[model samples]
Target: MTVRPASVDDLPAIADIYAHYVATSVATFELDVPDRDEWQRRHAAIAAARLPFVVTERDGAVAGYAYCAPWKARPAYRATVEDSVYVAPSAVGTGCGAELLPALLDMSRAVGVRQVIAVIADSGDEASVRLHRRFGFRDAGRLERVGYKHDRWIDTVLMQWSA
Candidate 1:
């Protein structure tokens, strides 16, 4: 697999990957699948801030993606960022995230980011939680019942990796 910075051409695949998570799981809190325009806007917003958005390519297709954005709107949190990652259904256990995350972290660090946060939608999503942990993120906190999705009340598992 080759890991590289995301480009405009990668938005469609990224949207499809995220749509799958939105429709089928509590891993993300998005209730509806965003169209390509929305995905484009999201990518632009991240790029406008000069942040990194990376996509993993395997056999000429996007397998997964990861990006970090400001943890909060407040300037006080500028040194920190919140990470988002989504893998294609077919690439879930194929180590796509393992490749994407480190690239994201490396890029973030190079750009002066000092903290990376993972706001996992479901506390029980061990795959995501473990992925962050594997990248040096530690359990920070959990907000009980912070979201209601798919007819279920879910907790937000917060994990952090600090440089």
Candidate 2:
């Protein structure tokens, strides 16, 4: 497996992974799965802002992806970043996340980002929570019932790792 910077060519696979999460899980608060054009636009915007967007390839296919973007719009959040990671269901537990996450952290450090935040879907998301914790992320707070999906309310847990 290899972790590398992502490109427009990787957007389709990335969108697939994200769409899966949007349709089946509360990992993201977004209710609607975005179309390819919107996904491309979002990716392009991130790149245009010079943020780090990375992908992990295994056996010549995109197994997962990870990226870091500004935590918030204000100048006070400039030194901090928010991270997102998505792995194809087939790639789970195959070390795709393990490979991509460190690259994201390294990218953050390389760009002088001081803190990395991960907004987990809920406390029930053990994999994501554990992965972030293993990478030195700690629970920052939990915003109760901040998301609605699948006919239920889902809480969001905020985790943070200092660089």
Clashing pairs in 2: none
Q: Would you estimate the TM-scores of all the predictions?
A: 0.97, 0.96
Q: Model 2 clash tally?
A: 0
Q: Write the per-residue lDDT of candidate 2 for residues 59-146, one digit (tens) a residue.
A: 9999899988788999988889899999999999999888888889988888888999999888375999999988889999999998
Steric collisions counted per model: 0, 0
Model 1, global lDDT: 0.92
Give the residue spans of candidate 2 off by over 4 A.
none
**Model 1 residue 29 CA deviation in Å:** 0.6
Tens-digit per-residue lDDT, 1-163, candidate 1 = 8999999999989998998989988988889899988988999999998899999987999999999988999999989999998899998899999999999999999999999999998746589988899999999999999999989899998999998
